[model samples]
Target chain A: MKKLINSPDSVIADALRGMAAAHPALSVDHDTRVISRAGGAAQGKVGLVSGGGSGHEPLHGGYVGPGMLDAAVPGEIYTSPVPDQILAATKAADGGAGVLHIVKNYTGDVLNFRMAAELAEDEDIRVSAVVMNDDTAVEDSTFTAGRRGTGATVVAEKIAGAAAAQGADLDAVTRLVTEVNDRSRSFGIALHAGTVPAAGTPGFELGPDEVELGVGIHGEPGRERGSMAPVRDLVAYALEAINADRPVGGDVLVLLNGQGGTPLIELYGAYAEAVDWLEGHGATVTRNLVGNYITSLDQAGFSITVTALDDELVRLWDAPVETPALRWGR
Target chain B: MKKLINSPDSVIADALRGMAAAHPALSVDHDTRVISRAGGAAQGKVGLVSGGGSGHEPLHGGYVGPGMLDAAVPGEIYTSPVPDQILAATKAADGGAGVLHIVKNYTGDVLNFRMAAELAEDEDIRVSAVVMNDDTAVEDSTFTAGRRGTGATVVAEKIAGAAAAQGADLDAVTRLVTEVNDRSRSFGIALHAGTVPAAGTPGFELGPDEVELGVGIHGEPGRERGSMAPVRDLVAYALEAINADRPVGGDVLVLLNGQGGTPLIELYGAYAEAVDWLEGHGATVTRNLVGNYITSLDQAGFSITVTALDDELVRLWDAPVETPALRWGR
Candidate 1:
């Protein structure tokens, strides 16, 4: 693999060290593999924590900050963090207001976060959990028993973070996050598979003229392998799937996310095409984010996320968020 | 060859359209191929304008905002923008305090921006220019006459933009950017070649376990090709080259930028290694940017940019600036 890494075993730790060094706003726990805000959790504010695998960066770790996540526990690449790690993060993030755990739909992540929440409660730390299953690509995948969580995880975290910053209780934060997941859907297409550092080879290979539509973030096989087509056609296919899953209409927030290896120009181009298509079908895109937000470790593809935005959701999203990955109005 | 583009001919236009849609804060003129902050340049403020080839995204277009460039002109991928586009941008961004043209050292870019300035002078608009030649990689390459401008362009624009926002006149802004360029040096390494949409092929090729150290942003031949080494070895080599060109000590601002395809996790890992090496050598890295700021399409590599920072530059950089690609204080 032509990746800039020292050893596969040290990728997460090395990255954590670098993240801590680069962002003074974040404090990394080398022992627990947890990244928390520099000042720890805010007192009397709803504490938020999230984590999954390591490859999809700027996700859990990048989301830790004042207005977003209080702590992020990262595991090995494409693997879930252990329950102990999650428990440690939860405890570290628990302030007087209570803590909220943002867990993805992966079986391992869900189970571990569940155990972590229970463990935190055993220590008398109030904890609530919101499980995200927003990927419409597949109902089940290699590591997931339900729909895989993808782009909407960012949307959920941002809105929930804003709500928490507003001094919302854990239950309110939980409800808002769950509502975001229910109102959102995402679909991805990969032009090439990403090579895992440890594997030293592409997770999968594609024919020169083929792409995997509805590809999972972990490089899992997608809906089908189809011949290469124009970007417009590919965009239409993904949007159609997303629209079908959740009839995209009214004011919606769109995320035209690159799956790592794609260039920003292409993602913007895709965003333009998506906007044109969505407006043509009568949906008004109220707000949008275009870049590599939730990526698949250099997989050359893109994903589209559509979230039907309510007035409160729009207000919360527009509210100040100060995270490494998503920052604005701060 | 695998890219998410409608056609090689329409890449720039499509991307521009998407940029306009995604960032309503900036206005894009399809006819002039320039992206300016919405509502045009701030009246009475010294206008800052920059542009070049389109491939290095979030550079010119993404940097247009209140505290950054007043306007950006983008040409075709890896091709310098025409004098007409530059002239249009210059005219539009000409505030009463005059406009500062931030041109890279590429032959086409310099020539075009010069001609554009002359054309603007014909319209009785005051203009000053700063040509950045900060790349320590090569003195001359396929597309340039002197050192190619690389990551330092971001630093120059950011500081100059801050100066402009503070009501600095054209001359002051020009001096700040020029000094920033002189103080910064950058070196890049490419593990794999980036494919240009128009070419339908990789610009260059590398063996399975090889990398081109000191590679130019446009895939120009670097210092040498060698077998892939550990990330520490790679980091050491890059830092050694940078320190040789400009002995990096004292307080410095470092940017560990991805060459497009490299993931953030790896970049952070590289950042950690760089910090260890720099601190070990008695240099204090006061501020840093670790992400894909300046990119060469989806090239699989990274570049390190270190700017010996002063109190003034730090204060200016810390000032509020809002742009699509780089935003912090604001």
Candidate 2:
């Protein structure tokens, strides 16, 4: 309930205003709830577009810029953006090369993006989609019918956006996204639940000594809750689950992301433990990010994302990126 | 009392390990507790070095890079780093020109950094110090003798670091830092208290509906406490106080900083409010930063920093920065 917002109803709209003011490079359309690069789509370049519910910030809207997403449509808190907004973003971001819809695997998001793609195609725009289902925490969660997408959404957006910015064809960019998604896996834990602004309370609660493991991004139920242990053990459990499914090894990219509310110091601590665990398992993490890149509101927890990287993916990731949320190598 | 840490005793060391693993561009000396550029000091460049207690992350540590501090020393949570660590960082970061020590105006930190400067003098390394006391919240607090430094540390580091990186001498860099400190003013509000790891609890407490109006970075007592109002009113009050003393006008740079635990969405909302307030008061905010640049450990609130910019500071502000936390134009 202690959130810095005018009202629950205006969080998304007001935040968009703030985003527009803070970053003039990205143009935010209040009417359609779309944030896009100021220059719009480039001719003959594959356009990258993504959208989802609000709350998990710096994900879609924060990623919209030159070397990442072209446009992003944000819905209300933990609710999917309607097809109209998605269609608007798709049309605005589309160039002669085409548009790629980066859809997370939640049921509402996937369905809406799909509908929007169909609508774009009806309007003579070529559209392709890559649905991300990278979270290894659960096969199905409260808001997702399949495995929910989490940290890999960021990894996919960055790499694929770079490929698109390289003037790759639509097919090539879509293939790169598929390759990145195939190589990435994520798992999350929550020390505290994120409060939904509309609800005026946390969706779930934990006892002072309790913690949630294998948590979803929307403050949904996790795999288990237990007495709080040291962060080393928590990180080990999460990474063990991820590496077991993905069989992580060789050169890899890691993102030890904070699930909001957790301080950077603890995220770095978790990053250290995650690196130790991955190295012990014979994985050489060549590139890594440790911060609140993909967050779940103000939930005090962390997520570990391991993406087995190839030279091409590494090159793409190393390319310049300039956005409000994720910017580097520019 | 919930946090993602190993043992309370090992919080700083463990976090340092994580930082070392995550950012290879910066070399972390575990023994001395210093994070410095990987290549050490560049010859003839005025080296910038800073250190303080841990918890306020990305302040000193995250600012060490090509265009920022040459080295950072971190101590235990909310406690001043020792003279030995500061002395070691000074020696490592000192180039032929000199080294600038950016110390926050906490008593222990002032005494420690001053001692280290004397020690560095004995080692024949030129050292100039700038103690920033820019917090407008309180004149004296739990850990400070004078006004405590908060958000302005980041601003001073960025501007002064750019000056030093441009081959400015120690005196020039010191002068630039003093100018930045003089023009910059910051005010913070904590929705909840920050918990120090060793203490196993928040430094203080607030009622469910109450908030500290001008809280210090370490959860020190602020100017006043009142029932939580809409973010607009809260922002107005803080900015009104800052403008009352400084009379903000013309082109100004703003930093709407989140004090850890707040979500990005809320931060952006606060940013929007701050901008509206500033513009309404006849101030022109030309450049701004909205994020968790300087943070209290897991405290839910934010701080507003405004620096009235002249042409020189504006040019220095626009200079390329390639640090782990703050990077742009590179």
Candidate 3:
């Protein structure tokens, strides 16, 4: 893979160093791979912590700041962080109120975050956890028992972060996060697979005229492979899958997430189709995001995430957020 | 090419539709292909208008907002906007004060923008233009008379847009934009060429182990093609070339821009090396942006831009900007 990296083994560490150099508002703990706000956790507020593999950048790490995550612990590329790393992140995020762990539903990640929560509780800190499984791609995947978590993690982090910033208690923040995940669904399609730096090759291959429907972030097998079609057709297929799982209607927040290598122009084009599809099906988009928020290395693909929104959820989403990846109203 | 577009012919139009759907704060004119703030130009405030080819997104179109451009005109992919479209944008952005056009150094863009400015003057709208040619890779290139304007356009827009928002006259905004271009220098390296949708093939080719150094945004030939090196070495080479053209020292604003296809993690990793190289060469980074701001559709590469900054420029750089792509502050 012709990646702009020093080496595969040092990718996460090197990126963390760069993050430290780039965002002085953030404090990076190199030894523990934890990224937190420069002034530490907010006192008397529920701290939010989320993390996973390193490839999905601007996710967990980029979400750390006021009105968002208190800390992020990135693991190796496509690998879950160790229990020790997660524990360190939990400790760093702990405030007087309590801490909330926003864990994506990968088996490794779920287990590690659970272990870290236990470890934190043993040290006299209160902790609550919410596991996100928003992807409607498949029932099981290579590294996941349930639906693989994808774009909803970003939505969850945002709304929950807003709640925490408003001084919501741990239980209230946990309920809000769980509600966000429950009301959300995602589907992804890949035009090309991303190559891992260590592997130096794409995890899988597709025919020149074929595309993977409902692909996972880690290049796992989707529901099926199909011939290349127009963006409208692709978007319709994704929306159909999501609607089949959960009927999408009413005011919604939409995320048209690019899988790293897709250009912003194309993502915008795809999002237009999504808006049309939603409106045709009785759903009105109230808030939308169109860009690469959760990415998988250099994979050329896109995912559509729809979250049925309430007035409270909409208010929280519009609240000020000051993070590297998602920031506004500050 | 495997792009998420309806068709090669309708890429720009479809993307514009999506942009309109995504950002309600911005108004898009389908007939003229001009994007402007929804509420129209600010009265008595210097209006900022920038435009060019379409592929480098979030450059012109995404920068339309309260603190940025009053209007943007996007042409067909990799093709300059016509005089009519630019003129429409100029008219839409015109206020009582004046209007400023920020043009990149491409031949077609310069010619088209110049024609539009004359047309606007005929209609009694004061118009001033600043041409950006900050690339230090070559003195002359295929589509450019002198250096190719690359990453410096973003810096110019932010600073000039701030000046305009602060009610600077057309002359002052034009002068500040010119000063930014003069103090800035940029260099790019590409691992792979981006495939234009119409062409259905990469603009250029490279050996598996080789990279194109100082490559232009349009896949034009750069300074040289060399074997791939570590991130530090590559960053050092870019910094040395920039330093050779103009000695980089003192307070500076840096942009480590990815060429669409590179991952954010890799961009951050590359940014660390850029910070190190700048500091080692006696330049201190007062501000930095590390992501895909200006891109060449799915090209796997990066460009580094350094702009020498004074206190006023630094303050302007920190000013609030709320664009679709680059946003911060209130």
lDDT for model 3: 0.92
Residue A165, candidate 2: how far off, in angstroms?
0.8
For candidate 2, lDDT tens digit of each residue in B206-279? Answer: 99899998899888899999789899988998998798879898899999999988999999999999999899
Candidate 2 — which pairs collide? A330-B330
Give the per-residue Cα lDDT of candidate 1 at A109: 95
Please list the residue runs of candidate 3 whose C-alpha ends up more than 4 Å from where it truly belongs after superposition.
Answer: none
For residues B1-330, write the lDDT of model 3, one tens digit per residue: 788988999899899999999999999999999999999888899989998998898788999997788999998888899999999999999888989999999999999999998999999999999999999999899989998888999999999889988878888999999999999999999999999999999999999999999999889999999899888888889999999999999999999999999999999999999988889889999899999999999999999999999999988888999988878984
**Model 1, runs deviating above 4 Å:** none
Residues A106-188, candidate 1, lDDT per residue (tens digit)?
99999999999899889999989888989888889998898998999999989988999998998999999999999999999
**True contacts preserved, each candidate?**
0.84, 0.83, 0.80
Q: Which candidate leads the pack in DockQ?
A: 1
Tens digit per residue, CA lDDT, model 2, A187-219: 888988999988888879899999988888898
DockQ for every prediction shown: 0.88, 0.85, 0.87
* lDDT, residue A125, candidate 2: 94
State candidate 2's DockQ.
Answer: 0.85
